[model samples]
Target: MKKSRYIILLPLFISLTIPVVFALTSKGQMLENFKRQEKEMIFESQTIFLDEGDRNILKTYNKLNVYSSIGDKIQSKREYLEVQNEKINSRVNSLESSIIQFDKDIEELVIEVNKINEQVVSTKDEIDTNKKTIDILQSRIEESTVILLEYIVYLYKKGDYVTTDNDIDNIKSILLSGEKIDELVNDLYFKSIIQLTGQQLIEKHRDFVSRLYVKKLELQESENQLKTLRKQGILERNILDDKRSSKQRILEITKGQEELYQKYISEQLELERDIKVKELKEQIKLNNTKKKLLEKYNCEFVDIQVQQTEFSALDEQCANINKIIFAESRLSGIPLENNPLDWPVNPSLGISSYFNDTGYQRLFGTDHDAIDIMIPMRTEIRAPMDGYVVFIQPVVNTGYAYFAVKHSDGLVSLYGHVNQIDVKLYDFVKKGDVIGLTGGEYGTNGAGLLSTGPHLHFVVYDEEEYNDPLNYLNLSYLSYKSLPSKYQFKYKSDFKSRKGFEYADTSKKQSTSGSTFVIEGENELERQKYLLGTYAVGDFRNWDIWVEESIAGGIDPTFMMCVGLAETSLGKYLKSAYNIGNVGNNDRGDTKDFPNARSAIAAMTSTFNNKYLGKYNTINQLSRYGNKTGAIYASSDFNWHNNITKCMSHVKGEYIPDDYNYRISIK
Candidate 1:
């Protein structure tokens, strides 16, 4: 019985110890997992190792996918725009035809109206002549009536004269002797016959006058009807002309809109193609080694599906990383220098994400170690300082490409998401040397597993620990408006007044003045060149030559430089080498090349003098788009004139502003 009791107790003790052991094991596993997760949170690319065949397959697949997708989009968009443009062309043709017809109809109507007017004038003249003739006939009729009355009175008086008392016996004697009485009454009888004939003539004249009056009334009525028809024809012609003008105006507006839309689409597509093609080329370069290795090993392509893992604890650890970076900044002996480094990218493109951004951590599930610079994909990446490339990791399918440079004075810079690197390991680079092309496209080659978009991930290390890049770069060139409110307050003292032009103020100087084209003194010219960034490189380096040549060619030196900036960003990146002005000879295929940049400048001045001088001499005149000269100069871009003139104003140093959006593209 004692043995049975001991056995039951042993089972209960085993049950109690089993749960405790299990709980302890679980706690140890959780602690290990937390440590592994913390290690994965940092941007470490050392663990990503791929076989030769798999790397080639991924590189090729990514290239094909990116190019095919972009190509398809371009083709579809171009087709859609073409279809719309065709419709607009057809409408314009129809309107043009209708306008021609309207003009012809209006001309014909004017002729018809003129003919009707002539007929009305002739009818009026005839009415006037008829009135004059009727007045003459009425006067003759009155004269004849008065003479007839006088003759009647004279005959009555003759009868009274023969009634004397003695006449009775004498008249009886005369009647007995009738042959002698004929002489006495003959004169009276003749006068009375003349009067009767005159009265008959007057009656005929009155009838003729009545007929003339009726004809005059008919002529006047016909003239009034013809005048009404002339007015109607004019009204109809005016209405037709108005419709033609309205339609013509609409056609012009539609054509202009079509050009602008086509240009916008072309620019957007061109930018995308440029980025993808460049990325593909760089990938090909990177895969050359893998291709050789694959052939040597005769390795088959292996498909591996990588699962993305997430750890909620990583965010808290990243916050601690930020603290470590801040502590390093304080421990370092190096103080902030005044503009120690040139901007890696264009200053016009402001920063997108700041270093140690809290908002970035909340959205991305990790703290950002570096600043993400805003720029288009495939933009040139320049070294911030003279340094030697120490480390380079070209990204594969699940890894990001980045390169680190060991700069002087214990400072190190790592440029991340670089698809194309011009420098290799241990290669020395200058401060402004183009090291590689930028890459951060989602799912594209060299874009890491956690990339949000296309941007430069720039990180600076102060004594081997991560720090802010802004500590080295000049903050004065940056715009206050682009910074966050907190940053604005923090860097308020660093903001300086720039001498460049301001876009907000309209009262600034214009390009019309002759002084606008000349940078007054030598010192002023250098200052403007430095401000515009043209003094650093290219043909503008020989600024004295530019000024002398411009003056010889009858163009202003300042305006010429501004045009160069507008066309090619001061020859920083040109579409065609040595074609500084981008002047075309009306042939799209005509790519003219000058021997040197100075020669190209000379060619530009010559072209302007010979082709465009007398006609489009002024900036305002050249800006009249759709005019003879404006369309020839820049048909694709409507803002060409505004851009050039704005550059000119900036160069003259007339726009001194307290604050400006320095990131805006003045070109």
Candidate 2:
């Protein structure tokens, strides 16, 4: 029984032990499978599949299968991948070439745009110049047309048909061809003949012939009178010869009588000598009286000499005293050494009327000797030339006043109707001195009667006679020479005048402030700040602040602000954007709809950057963060990077951040 139990137990133990051994072997195989899978996965992750055909085909397969299943596919894939990589490389090269070509085309387009802009500006300038030329031409043409029409009308009125036809033809040519017309009216052919019609011209010619015939008849009558006078003169000459013969006979008869009288006179002289000797003795008695008379005469002569010597000494002393008085008077401003009258008034004064034959006399019958100046009341009257004040007093009968200034050149300036007398008679006055004001008691109506409306009835005369003041004054003489024949007359007016146009008051007001409003003081600063704020947002249309500042500082604010805009874009970056306070690069992102505050700042800052930093260094570095990509982009960082050293060099005492990473963050 024991032997049978031992055999069964042994067999059971052997069975269990065999099953355990198989389970251990299965576990070992599972661990090996996991290890192999892990190794494959890691290998697949690291390696790249190469292919020649359809370069993207390897990308579609599992990395493990790509290595295991690769046979002809592997060789073909390798060849295909080699061919594809070559084609891809070629395509990349072509795209690179196309991009380069595109860049070149863009540069050329920019140049072409600039050229077109230049052409546009040139065309605009040319158009403006053409417009100005056209305006000038139009004005000239209009003036010519009016003149031509006037000439045509004059010819028609004058009834000069032939001259009118010639003028009209010329005008028609000018109008049709737009040709230039002569400026000289005298040169025009029809100027003189255009005043009469054809029939009128014929009548005038007949009248001229009749006048010539009458003049010839008068000349014949005068010749006959001369012949009759010659006959009378011959008869008178014969009568005078007969009288001369009678006179010669009388002279021969009287010659012997004079000789007889001479002999009788010789005997009478001897008798007279004897009588004269007795008379001489009697005259001796009176000699003493004659001697006394001679003595008295000598005494009278001596007294006369003494008196003459005393008179000479007294005269010399008087002259010396007079000279001393004159010197003292000049120093004291008492007596004017020289005539103080300033330059003559109305030197350049416009002429209203001239000394013409028109019976229009200011002093009634006296002809108007000088031209009238059509000036307003209180017009500053000055002496035309250097002169001395001869007389300054009122007129005799007339209430009008006048002042006479005698010039060194034998000319006199007479001012009449003065209302005030600033300088006394004989007071020295220089040219341009305010002698008197105009229009005080003289009303406008009286002013017209006294003179022609507050005018300085300026009269120039050489010898107190009527001479053309217009010629001496270098004034227009058209009105003076156009006087009528019957009105020609001359008269002398008084030079002394105290009341005239020269006396009118012309004091000006002290201030001239009007109704216009003006801001002053601290309000100006507020205005400037307001302007700066307004300009920061780009709304700088109104130029009030600029105008005010320009007026204050005396500078053109428009030009200065334009320069600043070119420099800092009107301080836009110096301030802050509405969206992103004062932070720099705050609005940087790819979101198209988001606010590009940083871009605006960058654009403004870039201008300053280009000015401060060199194009090759800092600007090129900044281009990396921009849209362009190239070797230039690859060499620089994407963050805000600039040549701080270069920037600081350009602007001394200006701080440039060393840490570029935080620069954009810190405002």
Candidate 3:
């Protein structure tokens, strides 16, 4: 605490200079001008905000900055990134589908080409075998023809004698005449068996040549097919390369956009700081003037200290915060506005404890500074006034989440024990707009601060002092508009939960408790919980919580979702097993369990990014892999790629689930 001063003495040099300035200075012209300007600035602020109007006015006036909270800037930047990423992702997926199809086609062509190669090899081998058979037959036929002719000639020479003599068994007698004849007969009967006629040998040779010619034609046809396939593969690959470059360009452009948003945020922050500094300077000037007035009033008293010094002494002489203005009544500021503040929560204030209530007094060291409005979890908490949210503190070390809104005239409203904050820090919110939801009471896990039950801890502070909320609220307008049980009102309301798509069919999955709907949310972890039903059956605990998170590292959401669905059955874990790629199978004759989904998904996507990012543009390329056997993904399941593609369609809302038969009233 600062010590109170009764009087002050001016230093000798200070008093000399003060007399000089009083004689020579204009009659408060500068001071009056300053006061007028400050009052005018305040008046102008009430009617207009510099940020909402021409933002470029800051540059005109040399302000050099705009005022926006860093948190709000980050959030705004993030939303931009999300929307942009969504657009880029859509294009990428479209192009990638084509690329993947091309790959599949190319793979089929390769198989065809390989088959043609096999046929060509086989045909060439057959042609060679046929030629050798033709050569052997021709050699045998020529030798036999020559021997027959020689025998015929020899017979002619001797025919007159042999035939005229009418020799018995002339052929057998000729063979017995020499060992050569016997050898020829023995060879023909043994190894040769039945020698083919000369005409038969000639016909067989022609048939082999004809077969070889036909095979050569077939080989030429296969070679032509191979050439066509190679050309097509090259064309498809070139197209795929262009698509890949397009995606990369999109990524780079998105990165630059994010930087632009960040730069704008930085400028806004700097402007905010400058405005704050300027305001502080003005306030200090006004305070120092007030001190001079206070010192003049001190002369009215007869304290020795007051008699010892001049009225316009500086702090060096008086050592006082304010020289003479000490009474609380002299420090009255602007009065509250006539309009009443809106109720901060859906629940009425009468049902809960008021500020400084008997129970509140004992629970805390002093009477409660704020009213406690008891409301159920996830209830919409609204702002009492149009103000900018200046703070958001997430839960930390067993603490609950809380946020603060800075209103006009230094009035700040703080909300505690909240969850799922809808407004980011520095977000300008209108009256009755959602700021956050009520949290569980002080001691409840995740309730934020000290709470007794699911309720909102609302406090209104002016600068540093706390004010009773009842003072600002109009009881007539905001009294408890409820009957008996809060649950009946909470559950029966028509507030619909968010769905993934506009035409999403979630009726079949709807429940009376409003928990079973598997759909999207404001973020990823929420989506995982909804998809896996970790809140329902806990078949294999929460899995797939890392899908969107992996996207930050360049993983595609559709690819991840499809793989997760196909591999782990949307993390249903029916087999009580967990595998990100759905590839790992336990050897225990049963399904296995994983500790968490995040690490598993990380490991899986990391491997994928490493293996297929630049090399492949489609999931089919991942399925029928060409690396080492162990390195190949989904090789065992021939339909792995197809199943994943189908799942992707489902995730894209192009394929509705068969069980989505239930209906709900769309709001």
Candidate 4:
């Protein structure tokens, strides 16, 4: 019956995909694959926790907000602060569990397949031994038959002749033949039974082969399913890795900011609580309220400002406090307060529109309150001075976000269109520490309100009033502005071909061959390591090597540095789809991914030099050449030539030649 069953399933067995050595060789492969997945799971979990640690650190340093109530009275207003990719993580954990189960299943299948293979081998050996015994039995039966026939012949001869002495001997032999025949019959019967048993063993081996074939097919299907799941798991893990990488960079900014803010708050709160200072503030408020400029308890802004429809209740209160403080300072004969500030961003092409630009005035029916400095999306928005964040919120309806920092000098810098806030509220940040990332445009990083594209709306709260950032920074805000691109050309596609622009030739080889990277007997790798030490995350540390490669490709390393800074916000937010320059994503938001950052860098620089070398020898010419057909690099509101030049100057810590592109040496 078992043999019959195997025969019925035989045809299907031929199509089995799993190898016959599944127990020996393929089992090891499955185990190794499972182990690899296990390692990856461990690594990903570690990465996720690393992000949690950073968040916790930020929470610790930022002020903690706690509330207490006694007898139905609540004292709520005190200073302090504080990827839930929970779904992705849960799915990952689940995947790990399933993979573990799959491993166990494969192990069991391996054991079962091995046992069946052993039985088949043993069955085959039994069949071989039985065949030898059957052959030996057949030889004995043949010899016995020959002897019986000889006896029969002798008997016939003796019957035909008279009974002589020879005949008598033959008759005795015939009697002996009968006894031999009996033994031979028994032996032949035993051999027949042995042969039958060997046949059964052959049938049993067929059944074992059929069972192995079925298990192989089953194993193949199961392993394939497991591999598919693993493949998807890998892709999801990579996405989480990218998300984690972005967050890690933000954590670095928070490290400086949160610690500083905590110290500032702790120190300032202690000093302000002194009896004399408290009495002085109370006296000033009391004296100021006696005049018509303020009401007794509400001595902040002008009475008319309180009546204004544009200001929110919170805005009015804040304004009023500033007003009262300013009045007190003035009465005491204090000068209007100010801070010597550098441009928070680059020397912007120019203000997209000044603080309280007309569009805002129309919207709020009041003056615009911030200066819009045009910059790329994800540009690093630095702290204007040493300060702590007092407010951070997402005004989704307004189409952008904003954060406010209270400087120690009684000044405040409010930056808007910021989609990403690295520091929590009350976290202290230094004058030049990156506190957040810039965002604007209707739907780039985050949606924006009246904003058309990426730019920084910078404002200052000084002398109890919102002042122009332009006034403080004193930046060169040229009357005319446009995009900060060397040439203007509409993108036909984001993935432009490097081969299309391979004609730009360099007559002079760069003076140095990666010599600049050999700092203190350390090669480019060592220099990159040192440079990357300042960065919180090491994912992008390898990018520095691309700087060396670009120099070899005949582009200035200085310009490459500036371009990387301007485009990637100093790696704060990388489009991995992009090289340091997001040439892959046109300003219009058409994003295309490259294989990796290094290959993308090589391709972009090669194409850039090929297209622009001879045609636009100088930065200024590149800036002014948009009038020609297909020469549009920047859209509007800034000139790429001037912006990159200024940013390059900032990087070099000095001005470069007016004809920067044409200049042979940075020094």
lDDT per residue, candidate 2, 1-667, as tens digits?
Answer: 5554221111101111221111212323432343243223222321112123322222222222222233323344445544554454345435545545555655665555555555555545555554455455445545544655555445545655555566666656655675433222222422344434433433333233333333333344444444544454444444444444434433432444334444444555554555455445434533443334334333221122235564334443232222222221222111122222333454344555556423233224335556566556666666555444555543323234556665433455666556555664434455577766444235532132235455666666665454666444322222222322112111101111212222221343221122111222222233334434444444333334333222222222332233233223344543334221122322354222213432333232233223432133333343344324543322234322233222221222223333222111000
Higher-lDDT candidate of 1 and 4: 1
Give each model a TM-score.
0.27, 0.22, 0.23, 0.23
Which candidate model has the greater lDDT, 2 or 3?
3
Residue 127 CA error for candidate 2 (Å)?
Answer: 60
Local distance difference test scores for all models: 0.54, 0.38, 0.48, 0.46
* Model 3: CA > 4 A from native: 1-339, 349-351, 396-398, 441-445, 478-667
Candidate 1: how large is its RMSD? 42.2
Q: Per-prediction RMSD in angstroms?
A: 42.2, 62.3, 35.2, 37.5
lDDT by residue (tens digit), candidate 3, 459-483: 7877546787765654433322232
Output the lDDT of residue 60, model 1.
Answer: 49
- Between prediction 2 and prediction 3, which has the larger TM-score? 3
**Steric overlap count per candidate:** 0, 47, 7, 21
Q: Look at candidate 4 and tell me the lDDT of residue 58.
A: 23
| Minimal lDDT window, size 10, model 4 | 7-16
Q: Lowest summed lDDT over 10 consecutive residues: which window, candidate 3?
A: 11-20
Candidate 3: deviation at residue 147, Å?
A: 99
Compose the digit string of candidate 1's lDDT tens values, residues 1-667.
4553221111101111221111212323432342233223222321123343433443443454455556666767867776776677556557667667767866776776677667667766765775676566456545644544444344344544434444434434545564322222222222233245544643343344334333444445555555775677577667657766765766665568578657766876786678678667855754564456444444422221121132222343332222222222222122234545677777567787898675565456455667898778889999887666655665444346677775544577888777677886545577799999888888776776556788888878776576788877766566765664445433544554233433331243323332222233333355555534522256556665565445434466667776676666566656676676786633466667666766677667666655554445655444343243443455533356656655555565444221212111100
